[model samples]
Target: MQQSITPQHEHEHHESMKVFGFWIFLMTDCILFACLFATFAVLRTHTDSPFTGNELFEIPGFTAETFILLTSSFTSGLATLAMNKGKVKPLIGWLAVTVLLGAAFIGLEINEFMKMVSEGATISTNAFLSSFYTLVSTHGLHVSVGIVWMIAIMIQLKKHGIQSVTKRKVQVMSLYWHFLDVVWIFLFTVVYLMGVM
Candidate 1:
């Protein structure tokens, strides 16, 4: 005789699908960024561009932004570990630190954009500047969304503690946070380093 499937097994299967779906979404996200990167590559060397990369890019500021983001990623991992250990208080603390670091990153990025605009490096100035702003701003938008999602998860953690649902959410958030860090690493190398060079 064939055995019937259990409810617990069904639930596990469903959660696994949710994770698989998230990974699929991330793949599409990768495609979107890839297109933006390609656009930047083509426009990066347009002959009539007003500003050279080295003139507009600030090395020290970018370095600080990189450090902050990397730290935030580490804190996010700690949050996940806290959840796995069923420690709600430390999980909340770690999530708060990650959010604050993310906010700081956004603040610094906005300041940089504003300063560049004030110096006549506006997106409408040329193709190169347009591409640069679009790529960076798109990434900034993603980080902003992650921050909002994190706030919601923090609220849930407070209300529900580390239930199975909350645990899965925390895991997904950690995956997204780590993914952003990886993307920033590439952006730092391609955009900032290459610009300075």
Candidate 2:
């Protein structure tokens, strides 16, 4: 005779399915970003405008932004650790720091875009600028959305304490934050380091 699953066992199975589905979603996102990066690589050489990535990009500012994002990723990991410990206070604190760092990174990106525009290097100016702006801005938009998501998770944690549901939500957010940081590392290598070289 077939045995029926207990409620607790069934619930655990559901949770495992949810986590697997999320991983699938992340894989799709990885594909999307890969296409974008490929497009950027193809178009980066198409422009013969007076302004180039090497000339327009500010190394010190970009470096600072990179540092901030890496640090934020670290803080996000801390938040996850706090969540695992069931300490709502430290989790919120670490999440807040992550939010601030994410916002700072977005602000720096916008400033860089504005400076380029002021210098007459707009998206319409050439193919290179178009692809460059598209790639970077898409990443920035993701970061902005992630920041909002983080705040919503914080609010949930505040209202519900460290329930299993809240813990899962925070874990997902932490995964997203880490994914963004990984993408930025590749972007920094392809767009900035190569540009400078």
Candidate 3:
């Protein structure tokens, strides 16, 4: 005879499935970034404009952006840790810090993009600019989505407290935040460091 499924088991099963589904989404995102990277690589050398990565890329600004995003990832982890301990205030506090850092990173990126555009290095300026804008902007969009998602989760946590559902959401958001940090590391190395060199 088949055993009856308990409520605890049902909850656990759903939680595990949510985590598994998030992993699949991340894998697809990895593939998407890979394709974007390949496109950027291929088209980066095909510039018709005077503005190139070597000329336009600012090392210090992107470096600071990297620092802010990486710190946000760390704070995201702290938020997860706080959730695991069932501390609502600290969890929310950590998430607030993470959101602030995320916003700062996005602000800096937009500033950089505006600077480039002012220098006539727009997407229409060349294939390189087109691909560069596409790839970097896509990553920025992801971070923006994550920030919004984190805020929504914060509201849920405040209303519901640290239930299994909120816990899973924190876990998923933490994972997504870390993934963005990893992607930015690559973007920094490939698009900025190598470009400047």
**Separate clash counts for every candidate:** 0, 0, 0
TM-score of 1: 0.95
Taking the tens digit of each residue's C-alpha lDDT, what string does model 2 give over 88-151?
9999999999999999999999999999999899989988888898889999999999999999
Report the C-alpha lDDT of model 1 over 1-197, residue by residue, as the tens digit.
12455776778788878888899988899999999999999998762545878888999999999999999999999999888888999999999999999999999999999999998989998888899999999999999999999999999999999987888889889899999998899899988999889
Candidate 1 residue-wise lDDT at 82? 84
lDDT of 1 at 154: 98
Error of 3 at 152 (Å): 0.5
**What's the candidate order when arranged by decreasing TM-score?**
3, 1, 2
Per-candidate TM equals 0.95, 0.95, 0.96
- The per-residue C-alpha lDDT of model 1 at residue 43 equals 90
- How big is the positional error of residue 86 in model 3, measured in Å on the Cα after superposition? 0.8
Q: By TM-score, how accurate is candidate 2?
A: 0.95
lDDT of 1 at 191: 88
Best by lDDT: 3
Q: What lDDT is obtained when candidate 3 is compared to the true structure? A: 0.93
Q: How high is the CA lDDT of each candidate model?
A: 0.91, 0.91, 0.93
